[model samples]
Target chain A: MFLAVTGFAILRLHSLFAVVMLSGVYSLIAAAMFVALDAVDVAFTEAAVGAGISTVLMVGALSLTKQREKIPVHTPLLPMVVVLVTGAALIYGTFDMPNFGDPDAPANRYLVDRYIQESPKEIGIPNIVTSVLASYRGFDTLGEVTVIFTAGVAVLMLIGGARRRRRPDSRAGPEATRE
Target chain B: MTFVLAHLNYWVVVVLMMIGLYIVVSRGNLIKKIVGLNIFQTSVFLLYISLAKVAGGTAPIADERFTVYANPLPHVLILTAIVVGVATTSLGLALVVRIREAYGTIEEDEIDLQDDEE
Candidate 1:
């Protein structure tokens, strides 16, 4: 439901506001699902990154401009059909997903369990998620930080830099010329 | 009430999350986008807090009394996440202010049109 609604919003909404909100909706749903799966840490990170900070920045961009201008809209039928087919395929794939909280599930039996059981002695962190995110995947986290930093720098250098001055008042310029 | 409250955190998170997402996607105003972002970030806080609960455990302070304790790990993780969230928001807002100054408009289409003219 979250993905479907948000997908529609991203597709159909002309204004940036609706699109950002729909994206937030998508993140929120994912957070809930994370909790249901007993992955609280992932849920927390997603909620913060997906819902909170991103939305605020996007909306801030919405200010200082004319609210959406109306335009002749296209139906976008082909994209919708493609999305529907993709969604159906994804749902079909989920049939092979382990039941909710299955102890014997491959996911449970392998990676997460190994981390939970072995990390205590290895990395010495009580929280498996933290250990996984910080230690084993430390390089990935660093890369993510670098990406964000680069994005910030790129936006600043590109869109956030100096403004072009507007033309001087025509009347004032003409009066000065006449004088 | 407590039981419902515990379970309903998910729903609350969902609603707030959507509201934020809608603002970010549908709105052209950059400030509105940031506000939506904040709302979305808050939803994650709710999810973490819900999972951190130990049902019958007290606050995580290790004292002589209140033996049962809610998990401390989630709280610690959330604190870091909160810092990161703040950092991102400030950066994003800074970007928006700059965008407005440069483009002279916050509307995405307007900016694009202005760029095309340039």
Candidate 2:
């Protein structure tokens, strides 16, 4: 589909700017796909985070680095073989997975019933997803927020300062400032 | 034919995953590798959403008109994951910036050569 095509474009393009834009497009298409697959909440998050924030961050990163990818000197044969084997293995494993969208699949069974049935009575939320994410899995959300917080702190520490280097050969910038 | 149709979504996802993997493993550019990693992670999100489908289901929002709601668990999980993926991506990019500042080049082979000489 669109994702496959966009992914291919990203792979083939040497220009980091184009690749970054395509990645944003890929994320938007993925958000559309999520909407089609009954995941509106996920679609919203993907649209904002994947397409919006990630794209900006990448462009910022690209500004700090080279624009064009060098033509790889080594043949991609080994990586090609590895990807083929891994892909084949994954496709083979999919045979055991319940057919796409089967309601009775393990993924749709079990705690799902509890979340759907009990959530209304227990959480008093009209939206089952909200109930589950906010109440049932509140701790998980807290942890996810914590993860984002940690990442923010890490990014700030990594690149927040505009430290000056006396010489290009001076190794003190990254090592000395890094803690 | 039915089998292929049934699993068509998965096959596409697998292809996307492979492409991402190839980019990561084959390319020397650090930024390119990070973009590859983004592709890989997005495909995984697709796989999860695909699995959450229930044929004749509406979005996980509960409504009286709709009896079937797609799995809510995966939606919740993937929502968190998307955010986390961005977090990790920003982190990776930060490291790339640092690497560029430190080494004066972002090519893996060039960095390797520099390391070998030292």
Candidate 3:
């Protein structure tokens, strides 16, 4: 309910600054909910990345862009209809899903049992989530790290080239005059 | 009544997802669109975490005192995903900045208008 309110608030707000702040608050509330759902690690990450890092990045972006969302001119009827239809389909699809916390649901069975039962001895790590993330699925984490590194390099290159080009002020003088 | 109670989280997730989608589709501002994308992404994360829950389970830390733990696999996956989400978000913002530099406007309509003249 809290998250839903935050989402709606974000939708209604025109100020990008308020939107960014609400998003951070939304993430904080989501992190709290994650704790309720038995995903402490995810909650931690979401608080840091979704709330902390993303908010900072968005503020930085807003510094370079407009602060207010322009009131859209169109009626947006088509998009509203499309969203309603898609939402209805999603709700219908949820009918077949296991109840919120059924222990015997297909996803909670099989290898999950194995991992939980054996991880203590096999990996000798008390935290099954950590063991699985750092050991069982180490390669995936490595790839994800590589991806973050690539993103960093890509941002630098994209922004770096622009800065370098700006330094050649004499050339920009001619272009500015021609325009 | 039981059905609604059983799937409460899912219903909320769907609503949130739709809200995000609506913002993304209806809004013309580029920054607003990115905020919508963030909302959309967060809702998906909520869905995954909700699915990983076990009614009586504790957190996925191993202990003899605890008999059941929520599925750790999804937690692991979501952790990685959250990191990736931030990375992509930063990248997208960088692109937006570059676009603003080139076009001198971040309004989608304005950009389209400028393109049409060219």
C-alpha TM-score for every candidate? 0.54, 0.94, 0.95
Name the runs in model 2 displaced over 4 angstroms: A161-179
| The TM-score obtained by chain A of candidate 3 when compared with the true chain A | 0.91
Candidate with maximal lDDT: 3
Q: Once model 1 is optimally superposed onto the true structure by TM-score, how far is the C-alpha of residue A80 displaced, in angstroms?
A: 2.4
Pick the winner on lDDT between candidates 2 and 3: 3
Question: Which 10 residues in a row give candidate 3 chain A its minimum summed lDDT?
Answer: A167-176
The number of residue pairs in model 3 that clash at the backbone is: 0
| Cα lDDT for residue A37, candidate 2 | 91
Model 1 alpha-carbon drift over 4 Å, by segment: A2-19, A69-72, A95-100, A162-179, B1-118
Residue B54's lDDT within candidate 2 is 93
Q: For residues A1-179, what per-residue lDDT tens digits would candidate 1 score against the true structure?
A: 45445544554566656666766776677677556544466567677766676666555545433345344244445544554564455445444544332345443344543554466578775565566567877775676677567667865664434333323432222213444
The lDDT-based order of candidates, best leading, equals 3, 2, 1
How would you order the candidates by TM-score, starting with the best?
3, 2, 1
What are the per-residue Cα lDDT tens digits for candidate 3 across B60-93?
A: 9987899989999999999999999899989989
Model 3 ranges with Cα > 4 A deviation: A167-179
Model 3, residue A111: displacement in angstroms? 0.6
Separate DockQ for every predicted complex = 0.11, 0.79, 0.79
Candidate 3, residues A1-179: lDDT per residue as tens digits?
A: 99999999999999889999999999999999999999999999999888999999999888777688787899999999999999999999999999989998888886899889999899998889999999999999999999999999999998777656664433332233444
